[model samples]
Target: MRILLTGSAGFVGSHLVERFLGEGHEVVGVDNYLSGQRRNTELFLRHPRFRFVEADVSAGLPVEGTFDAVLHFASPASPPHYQQHPVETLLVGAQGTQHALELARRDGATFMLASTSEVYGDPLVHPQPEDYWGHVNPAGLRSCYDEAKRYAEALTMAYHRHHGVDTRIIRIFNTYGPRMRADDGRVVTNFVNQALRGEPLTVYGEGLQTRSFQYVDDLVEGIIRLLGVSYHGPVNLGNPDEYTILDFAEIIRDLIDPRLGIVYEPMPADDPRQRRPDITLARELLGWEPRVPLREGLERTVASFREVGEGRPERVGVDA
Candidate 1:
């Protein structure tokens, strides 16, 4: 299949490109590099079945071709990137999504959206389910990302229902692995980088805030399965294993350097107090569940970070 994938230079998007190319699919990747790295696209520049286009999907997709699948993964995902480019975040979720959907409609192709767990926004529900209406703040510090994904999901459904476009929406949980930007301000990269440098790991607030981390490979697998399945509604794709910020910090410290200390700092506003995806829907529908353990995934991630020597102590965003 020939696939049109936006945000192909992103951490997760790059992984998807590898998988898709390996499976003998022709992929046309698009990215604006707002948060994605150009190095990622370089990994596939020589691939026979891959092509990369440098353009922002928010304005338009410049590629001209009828694709079998259109996966919309563009947008600044991390707090720093989205907060820094708040308007771009909103535009991508609004205009970028519309552009992708329109292209998919034009080609009569399958459409898949990469939505985030931020939509839950300090979820009141203990373990969030697909049926739960999220507790998101429409106007808040994190609203740029949270509301954008929420609106994107709504738009995806609207396109699916009204236009009969084949659509899939996967609510991605806290995914981390190699290719993650060290300066992205996410907790995983921050802790890993700081630990590698033998610096005190920064833990926001009491470090009681919980999050479910999903390895990128596992997430890519779930995405592949969802694409093959017939489900049209949103499905949670993440690991069920939960960990507090403090405990996660300890794990990273142990992996990198056991002597690294943990330091508490002020929590960011609208940070989710808890997040654990109820993947029961994913399990029953797609027969998918995260396979990589946290420690193992962290080991691989640390190896990648160490190889590149990427580390810096900065304000960490706990929202995954």
Candidate 2:
């Protein structure tokens, strides 16, 4: 099948392109490289089954021809990227998503939205399930990303219900792995880079806040599986294994250098105190659950960072 995938140069998007191509599908990739890396697309530039276009999906998708599937993965996913380009982030989630859905509607294609766990802002629920209404601050600093995704999910459902479009929404949790930008300001990258540089790993507000980390491979697999199923509601795709910020920092320190120091700072406003996905729905519907352990995933991530010498940085910041 031929597929049209936006954000093809992004960390997760690039991985999806590789997976789709490996499964013998033709993919037309699109990205404006806002937060995505050109090196990622370069990996598949020469592939016979892959084609790329440089365009921002928020404005419009400058592409022709029909596709079997339309994967709308475009957006500034990281905190720094979204915070830096707030308007663009919001536009991508609103206008960009509509454009992708329109294309899917036009060609009678299966549409899949790449939503995030941020929609469950500072969630009151311990383990976020598909039914939770979420506890988000609509006017907060992080609202740009959180609300954007919430709006995207709503639009996805509208397209599905009103137009009879086949749609899938995957609420991606904190994912980390190869191709993650070193300066993206995510916890895993921040800690990994800090440890590699022999610098003090920065932990915010006593480092008691917790987050569930999911490996990219596990996420990509769940995404592919979702496409094959008929479930159109939002599905949680993440690791249920939880860890506090301090404990996670120690794991990174142990992996890179046991002697690395850990420093505490004020936590960001509106940051979620806890994040753990209840994947019972995912298990029952898609027969999917994360398989990679945090340590092993971090080990592989560290190896990837080392290969590219990507640990040197001024200071560490996290999306959470």
Local distance difference test, candidate 1? 0.89
Regions more than 4 Å wrong, model 1: 205-208, 265-273, 310-320
lDDT for each residue of candidate 2 in 189-253, tens digit (9 for 90 to 100):
88998888889999989887777889999999999999999999999999998788888899989
For model 1, where is the 10-residue window of minimal lDDT?
311-320
How close to the true structure is residue 157 of candidate 2, measured as C-alpha lDDT? Answer: 100
**lDDT for every model?**
0.89, 0.90
Give me candidate 1's TM-score against the actual structure.
0.93
Question: Which stretch of 10 consecutive residues in model 2 shows the poorest summed lDDT?
Answer: 311-320
Error of 2 at 60 (Å): 1.3
Q: Quote each prediction's TM-score.
A: 0.93, 0.93
lDDT of candidate model 2 versus the reference: 0.90
